[model samples]
Target: MKKLFYLLSFLILTACGDDKFSPGIPDIGIPEVEQPKDVDSVPVVEVPEVPEVDIPDPVIPESEEPEPYRPTRKIGKTYTFDLVEDSGIDQTKAIQDVLDKAENGYIDKNGDTIVNVIQFPEGKYWTEGFDVGLKKKYVIGLLNKEFIDIEASGATLYTKAPGHPYGGDIGKGRYSHRRHFWIENSKFIEIQGLRIEGSNTIQGDLLGTTKAYTPDFWKAGGLDRGAHGDVPAYASYLEFEHGYAVNESQNITFDNCSVYGVWGDGFYLGNKVSEGGSRNIKILNSVVDFVGRQGFAASVADGVIIDNCEFKRVRRAPIDFEPYGATGYVNNVRLTNTYLEGFHGGIAALGRGQVNNIYIENVKINSPGPDISCWDSAGKTVRENWHVKNLSRVRSYGSHVGSIRFKKTNNITIENSFVPIAKSQSKKSMELTDCENVTITGNDFTNGLYIISENSSVTAKGNTPKQEIIIE
Candidate 1:
């Protein structure tokens, strides 16, 4: 019985432990494998630490930024002011109002005003006078900031009777008396293709006219104090009428313009109240006809260039470089390709002020009347010092005023020129009085004497003097 019971238990245990034979009992079949205890037997890997970095923002270019609005024209906006023919109205106030409005218009993004160009249509405009680039009340400050271009093609600006009467004494022993156009304390101004007509009809000497020579006109005009003997009151009366007067300005240009029948100079470049002077003035392709005084006169000026111009029937010299102030000077003047006819003189540099660096080339002088003075002291001190300098190539035809004289001058060079004898007058062709370091070469003095004073130091070479070379 014990053997049968043990065999039965063994059979039961073997059946329970048999693979895939258990039906209802829970079965945890696979056991996890244990890791190795020897950690050095396996290989190990190492890693390095990383550093921190900073990144900046991207940059922007200048072209990518917003641009300021620019006008279509080169300078700025253009303003047009027109007039009617024979209007018989004084256009001064209306024109001045237009100028004021144009000058003070809207400021752009570039901080510039609206006034750059002023245009006038074809018409005959009557005006008393026009004051440009000046303050409204006082004669101070500049009106326009940028350049001003006045285009008045085929337009005439005629002066009214008693025009610009008594402009009320500006300082520096000077008066801003009369001018068809006065440009002061400004720069980069251009007047183009305009005609200016003044009141005076007298061509030659002002004294020759019955209207100007009378004591009533002189007394009425407050010009009687300065007149003495044969000499008219030029200092007082000559300041009363001018086509264009520029004061303390710079870079002013007059192109294709005409100035006629003016009592004073056609163009007067000067300064007021010791305010430096006018500088870099240019007159191109212009005409100054029938003027009472000089065609173009400069006092306290520098860098005056007159090119392709004509001066006819001027009572005084065509060009005068006489400083009116005590501390004034005229420097760097160049006149080329010009025609001067029917003048009292050719060119004059007077006054006590200094005149330096004058250059004249390809100039033709025709029918200059009885005073052809080139350089004179004008009753000032007659010293032996050389105060004036010149270089010229001039040809004088028809009747001349005795000779082309140079007195108290230095560093003169007269070359490649012609000076003929005075018609019906026994005079020399050229005269050098109290001059120094003169070089007269390649000149044709036909049938006329070339006179040099004892006080002159001259070197005459390669000159054609048909008559004698006299040393006075």
Candidate 2:
């Protein structure tokens, strides 16, 4: 046949081109994209252009304000002793230069020493006490108030010897003593129009009665009692702003000046050497003279405020709130616009036990004896709420007035006051006992009379009678 039909058609065209050029196994079905001859000539899918991100603009700044307290020298009449070199009167380098200038001081850390707020430049300051002692809050301060004058030869200003459990009651302590300018427990403390008496003469035991002028001024505060006293336990607050301790020295103060003869006790609030009894004390606008005894006495004190203060001569009770030794009693006390003169017993809030919330307002008391009094009782019995008021009294609590004199006192009030009687309208202005809601209001007593001391309950309003209002 044609050579086996062309060799079987070339082996059947090489087995159908080897099964149409298949290497593994193919049935072939991929090639059909020809439907776009005019689908807008199709070929548009180009979305590649992401570059538009830049944002930075928010700036804000400008503010300023702070400055005031300028002090650039203004202390006149200046003169210095060639900046000190005297070794003679050197009392331990003048009390170690006031205890290293009150403990390493200021003015840009002084190299030689001397703290000047200006005004010591009149000349004549010899110095001593370089040994250091008596300075705990003004061992000395006389910032010129008519010029510093202590020299009757400066009568031995501090000599130093004190040391021993001897805080005072005498015995066991004596450090010669010399305090020219020593400030302790400091706090803007100032002494204007200065005088400073007894300039640390070191004179103890003046003997007014000795256990330090008694009422036990509070011995046993710390209880050493060797010579008979120790006291070291009462210190909460002590302030004498606009000062004038003039003389006699014993923790004193005189505001708005004109203070007289300090032998101690013009205005003495306790603690420290008496063991405890100092509380928020305010003696406003002062003028207390010749303090013979108790011009203003705040006992075991809690809160004592004596406003618009002024007293004269002072024999005993210009104003007193007990508890130093009748046995100590203190709570809350207030005496406003006070003016008591030559006093024997003007305002006396006695103590054996009770004295809480005592308010004597718009007061103008003149006394020979018994203007206003509270007998703080607990002995025979009877202790209760006793509150008097706006008094211009004659005699109150004379017969031992007490809200608690019977161990069961109640609220008592004597308001809008003024009591000046004792032409003996038969005396006895106010005397209530075992009280209970006793209110004697709007009183212009003009004179005297009120003795309700035996199981009382009274309520009298607008106590009229231009001159007299008596009740027994």
Candidate 3:
């Protein structure tokens, strides 16, 4: 009875709590799962730190001022000429006295030949003319206390009569050429910030016509002061190698000056008296107006540059490169960034010697007459290798005549220029006579480019009126 009772109880327990086995048998099924071990006695690992890099600060630079121009010659001394205006003082003589002292070299009390920089203060000083002799490396400068001005009552050097002595001759007996400031044989001459005036209202005599030795006074005709003539040559500035063979004017500069109302040329170079002509001359930032003859004339020049200049109201050509006497050459010349207005002609190069390597660029010309006229040399004169570029006329129409007239020139280039004229106003906008090896390209012309029947070896490409390029 006890065994049946225990079996019934076990069956009841298995059904209620442990159905998978008898009531007490589940406790010993797995025995004991393996126990996990402790990690307290294991070895340790450590990570190293990265080192830092050092950076430096940046550095800055400072600007410095430019040094003043120091002339090569020893001219540590400065001398001033204070002339009295309207004091009945001959300002010419007063200025000439100091110039003579400078040219002759002033000996100090200590027996040292001190070079000087002669300066003229502001005053309306009247002078017939004053001359700067040859072989002077001194600076004839105008003192600009406030600014550079053509002072109404400032240093105005005036000339008196036609044949009168305004200034002294430039050189000794043979090389004597007259100018207000005649400079010759100077290694480095600086003329800056000055104004010169002449009486154009006064009737002037011809330079070569007034010789007493010849009875024929008007034989030379009405040539400009620096005109080139063949028959009974009116060449009088400096006869061909007439004087002592001095060194040509070199390293000379004309800056910030004004020249007006002159019966003669405003500025003249190419001393025929010297074997070597003027070289390395620079004319910059200046104005020349109302001259009876050319604004600037060059007979024989080697290495000349006319830059940033304004020429107006000139009677003859603004620039004349003709060596009137045919003794020297004009080479390596450049006219750049210049303005020309109201002139008969812009540039007329009748140079006897080879007028070669001439470059004219960035020029603006407003003329009522011809702009450029290169005279026909016909083997009599030699001109080659000319480059005219980037030139524009401000006005719509140039003149009744052709804008560019090329004659007897060779190896020329005219490009990137604009000539505003029409075929109705005349057929030829540019005329070339006896010219060869010319290339007219990239130009805007109103009328066509015309060449004579004799012109061979001429190329007109990329020019307007491409169909009507060569007009015989």
Please provide, for model 1 over 1-472, each residue's C-alpha lDDT reduced to its tens digit, 9 standing for 90 to 100.
Answer: 9989777766786678874544444667878799989999887877777787776777765677677666543456688875556545667766666666665234466665444788888887876433432223221122443477889899887753323232223454444355677777778778899898865543232221124234344334433233322222234434547788888888889999999876678888886537878999999999998776788888889899999999877767778888775467788888888887544557777775667777788777754442235453563433232222222224433343345676777787777777766445565666777778877777776656645465888877776664345677
TM-scores, one per candidate: 0.67, 0.26, 0.64
Residue 411 lDDT in model 1?
Answer: 80
Best-first order by lDDT = 1, 3, 2
lDDT of 3 by residue, 109-166 (tens): 5544444566767766655432433322111322211111111223566543223222
- For candidate 2, write residues 1-472 as lDDT tens digits: 9879767666766778765544445547888686665988777999999999887776665555566545443222222222233324443344333323332112333222222332222323334332334333234443222211111211222211121112443343332223223222222223323222211111242112123223232232222122111111110111121112222122222244333423223454443324445555456666665443456665565665677877665556666665655546555767787777644567666656546677667777655566656655444323455465666643432333321122234666767766545443544445555567767777654434444456566677676443232333
What lDDT does each candidate get? 0.65, 0.44, 0.60
**Counted clashes in each candidate structure:** 0, 50, 2
Residue 291 lDDT (model 1): 71
- Sorting all predicted structures by TM-score, with the top scorer first, yields 1, 3, 2
lDDT of 1: 0.65
Per-residue lDDT value at 338 in model 1: 88
lDDT of 2: 0.44
